[model samples]
Target: MLNKTIAIIGAGNMGTSLIRGILNAQLTSAKKIYASGTRMEKLEKLKTEFGVHITTNNKDAAKRVDIVVLCVKAAVIRKVLEEMHDVLHKDQFIISIAAGVTTESMEKIVGKNIPIVRSMPNIASTVGLGSTAISFGKYVHEKQHDIAIKIFEAVGDVVVVGEQHLDAVTGLSGSGPAYIYMVIEALIDGGVKMGLPRDISTKLAIQTVLGSAKLVKESNVHPAILRDQVTTPGGTTINAIHELESHGLRSMLIDAVATATIRSRELSELINK
Candidate 1:
């Protein structure tokens, strides 16, 4: 829980999810959090549901908080920053979750002296199982960095990385959930093809992925070693593994991440331009 007030400048999905996560984690009282957005009905709904202060003016929200969270889209982040620039103080911390919007670009909009932390959090944040990667700007101090970590930690896991590596983080964790979803869908289809009912296959596939992930986290062993443990001479698991290998699954996944990283860099360049 942070003692300082937080202002979320956008009431979009990620912003709303953070509000819910912070409240659910008891990291901060609703009274200390303020949300701003364009839609009156949405702001009113958030105020009613979360018991937090809500406003349509971004500058007003920024002026009243100790930390400002930029949750707007990459296309609008510059506009929001310009709107709040006059109200933002050097002492206040800024955390941005807009994909491809770098801290350097935000510094240009706000000020060179303002502390900024840029982060990438996946859609799983809504489910409290997100993986977030954070990077600090030149003006950010140790305490402000810790606060940024606490804010995201309320929703899920947090990892610190260099700003230069954020594009790679964006490629891996930020886009990884969609890849996992595709795999899960394929697994469910495979089960169904083997005569299992659709609903049963869905449950089995989801649970298998979830349980396997949990195992990897808890075992603290190499995944390949774990896979070897499940494989036996002339066995079903080995045959399945062989099939995946024959299909070039490993190389495909590697290429997917690499391609996503390249695209992330291109998007960042576009935003910075």
Candidate 2:
């Protein structure tokens, strides 16, 4: 849907995953995608693997692309922007994947009239299945929003959320994959304790977790109902569930989300300050 050249200013895990997705989706040709990093070795690795242009100059990357992706950590956003500020064109859209960095702060660096987008995407982008939320700044035109959506959607699902909710999205989805991984690991441990082989236990645990999520997606029924179907009264499932409740499983999950939300808010305040 687009022919505009794109440049990514970081070659880390998320950045590399985004590159893979963009190519797999055929959103742009390899020749049009550029990956940039300060490390020559990393840039060389991306160049060898993707056959795309790689560079160590952030300014050069910004100067040559229509859409510039800022994939660095939140703490590093200001530094990266300052380095590329002189070369950033007025027409370029700066799409930031840094958690907790707001569009308002980004605008201050790029000029309030320059287009900017702040987005949060989970790690699932590596496999072409991720959930992302984005907020647009004042200078982001309708066309720019469309382009931002296209770029994020190439990796996974994309939603445009109000700026106020970006932090909540970060807590809920950005950091959620790790929580899910913990649950999967605990389930595998349980299987292993039951005498199942470690590898088999882990495989079953992972697939079951994934399948359960797919069922929720494909079935219109409320999760509670689907859960109830498997949890017949006085059945083995209910017994296990009772044991979980005895150990405060549900409350622990709620506390986990709450803690993550509070921490995200703190980080946002720190960055904004």
Candidate 3:
């Protein structure tokens, strides 16, 4: 068990999900976790459901915790950092989950002395299956880095990357869930077009996607190899693959990730400015 107090500074969907994961994993006791937010109803709900301490004062939460997770939106991260600056100390670690908020930018607001970690966790985290990318600031120690990893691992898989590569991570895993959801929807629509009921199509599409991902992960085979294995000469699968290739499905997905990466970089620049 982690013997430290952690405070989540924004009790939104992501923050609440983390809290549930942390407690369920027994990384730390619920009493050691504090949640702060502006909405009284949300704060009280968290308190009642999780038995965590709740407060509206951000500084109070920051002052008492060994680790602070800033889950506020990117637009409000600077303001929250400024509010907690005086209470945040060198010994404490800060982790930010705000998309496009870099560790460098947070350091400027909180001062360079504080250790900071910036992470990108996709919406899948709500279901304890997130893919999170972590990047450490210059001041973070090895132990602090491990702590950040453990916290995120409770909710999903975690990867460590250089700060410079976090934008790419944001483009891929950070924004990947929506892309996958679209694919699932399209597959369901295709199933319906073939005369399947809507509900059955939805169920089949969801399970097929889930099982295919599991197969790729467990079999440790390249997805292309797996695709070839499924496709026989003049088979239905090959025909479907041909249609997808003709429609530029692969190219479109690649372009989508690239565009998202550029947008992430643009947001970072704007935040830093």
lDDT of each: 0.93, 0.89, 0.93
Candidate 2: deviation at residue 162, Å? 0.7
What TM-score goes with each of the models?
0.98, 0.97, 0.98
Model 3 — TM-score against the truth?
0.98
Q: Across residues 12-77, which tens digit of lDDT does each residue of candidate 3 receive? A: 999999999899889999989989999989899999999999999999999999999999999999
Q: How many residue pairs clash in each candidate?
A: 1, 0, 0
Error of 3 at 236 (Å): 0.3
Which residue pairs collide, candidate 3? Answer: none
Report the lDDT of model 1 for residue 71. Answer: 93
What would the per-residue lDDT of candidate 2 be over residues 1-273, giving only the tens digit for each residue?
A: 588899998879999998988888788888998888879987888888898999988888888889999998888899999998888877888999998888899899877378998899999988888999999988889998888898889898999999888878877898899999999999999999999999999999999999999998889789889989999888899999889999998898788877888899899999989
Question: Compared with the true structure, what per-residue lDDT tens digits does model 1 show for residues 27-110?
Answer: 789999999999989999999999999999999999999999999999999899988888898989899999998888898888
Residue pairs that clash (backbone atoms under 3 angstroms), model 1: 1-27
